[model samples]
Target: MNSEEQPILSIRNLNRQFGSGCRECGGGSGQLIKNYCLSCGTVYACRDLSFDVFPGEVLGIVGESGSGKSTLMKCLYFDQETTGGEGYISTYKDGNANLFAQSSQEKRYIRNHLMGKVYQNPILGLKMDFSSIGNIAEKLISAGERNAAGMEERGMELLTHVSIPVHRRKEAPRNFSGGMQQRVQIAKALSNNPPILLLDEVTTGLDLSVQASVLDLIKGLQRELGISIILVSHDLGVIRMLADRTMVMLDGKVIEKGLTDQILEDPQAAYTQQLVHSLL
Candidate 1:
């Protein structure tokens, strides 16, 4: 790939504002507030956001609760619709076409074939009633892999990859510990070997040790598979462990972005400084 090549993913001026603009709220723009609209009771869960994730790089998005980080991830994976913006996935249109302009079927294909996600809550990522193997199979099935033997083999390989014993492949996630369940979720997400992965607060509810192990697993996967990843986390520790570059968000806007070392050692934004200080 050329050094000047476009980003694997690019988002331009993404907006996901709720409620119609009103005069009292400055038409829902121009520094009216962070999220809520005093005029029309609107919410801007995402607002005028733009960034890029380069191939084989981990782009960390860090923000506190209600900072619109999760919302941005959802929009990237098409879990939620964008109010306005242009998104491009290089694998789809050589990084020139807008992703939101694609048909529903096209979007689904991109999501299924090009992207993978591990939700913070295992429940969102795993089916409680289904066996661990079955959950992995579901994703394989979505991507049109129909051979039962192949699915089972891939599922087993993934389970082992995440450090889940193959013996428990037939058990449901609900039967496992929180960390094990999360491992299963990671297994399921990687079943298809998608090039891009989205991880949303993936270690939030786990214990410190568990969190370390999970983060290590992710780092290993990135190194081994060379997958481009968008990692959304409020925890600076998580960001520091995984991210090559970082984007700091405050009130639905990016306040600072640079290499992980730069953000941690020499933050520019006041909010980022406050955040880094709290970590000490």
Candidate 2:
């Protein structure tokens, strides 16, 4: 992000702990001896994670399974309650208020109106039984849009934007191929033109060719719409293709972060170097 322009979203000391506390493990403080405390079974799913996502930038989070990438995304979207920290979106309250501090109703408003998310599983992101347009309309409905014609028109536009045929708008996502289902999810996520988009391993199970097409569609949409995006994936290749800046996460902590090219070229962390070499 440029020094002059403020980040669209800023996350500060974000923490998500899966257990209450355990004195033997420093009660969620000091050195975390293990992810699970022998005494309390408290799991520190995420540490004091912090990052900023600038408008119109794709910030990629790459890590292996159990690296806490999905957990972080869930916390950001409020699907999983955060244990601690402040989250602010510039589009909300002139960027002066922490999103986590907002009332439940206010939080819902922000989520439905300002942020959009697509999960790895189509079932989570798309309603298999709903028509493609019906699924997109669900978000618009949540945003208080009641005009049926407008919703249909908007859905058509989004489907077209994602390269889905207009005639298929009435078809169920369950009947579409994996790639088509993912495109439907993308359309649904963009239904409200949210400033921030969260994608959690959206292409993990797809064929290589399908993955490439979805990745390309994502890049095109982000550029065309100028939305800030956080793409979580285990694939460094996907991150390299789409991220302007990248954050490397391991065991719930960000080990390294920098321009995508710089991090790939001269990684400082051992884990990051290993990741780069593996790609090579």
Q: Which digits, one per residue and each the tens of the lDDT, describe model 2 over residues 1-280?
A: 5532899999999988888876777745644654566677788878889999987999999987888889999988888888899999987998899988888899899889999999999898888999999999999999999999999999999999999999989999999999999999999999998999999999989999999999999999998899999999889899999999999998778999999999999999999999999999
- Please give the clash total of every predicted structure, in order: 0, 0
> Using alpha carbons, what is the TM-score of model 1?
0.96
Model 2 regions lying over 4 Å from their true place:
1-4, 30-34
List clashing residue pairs in candidate 2.
none
- Model 1 worst lDDT window (10 residues): 24-33
lDDT, candidate 1, 1-280, per-residue tens: 6833568888999988778777776645644657788768878888788998888999999999999999888888888898899998887867677998888898888877889998888898889999999999999998999899999999999999999999999999999999999899888888888889999999998899999898999999899999999999999989999999999998778889999999999999999999999998
Q: Against the true structure, whose lDDT is highest?
A: 2
Q: What is the lDDT of residue 79 in candidate 1?
A: 84
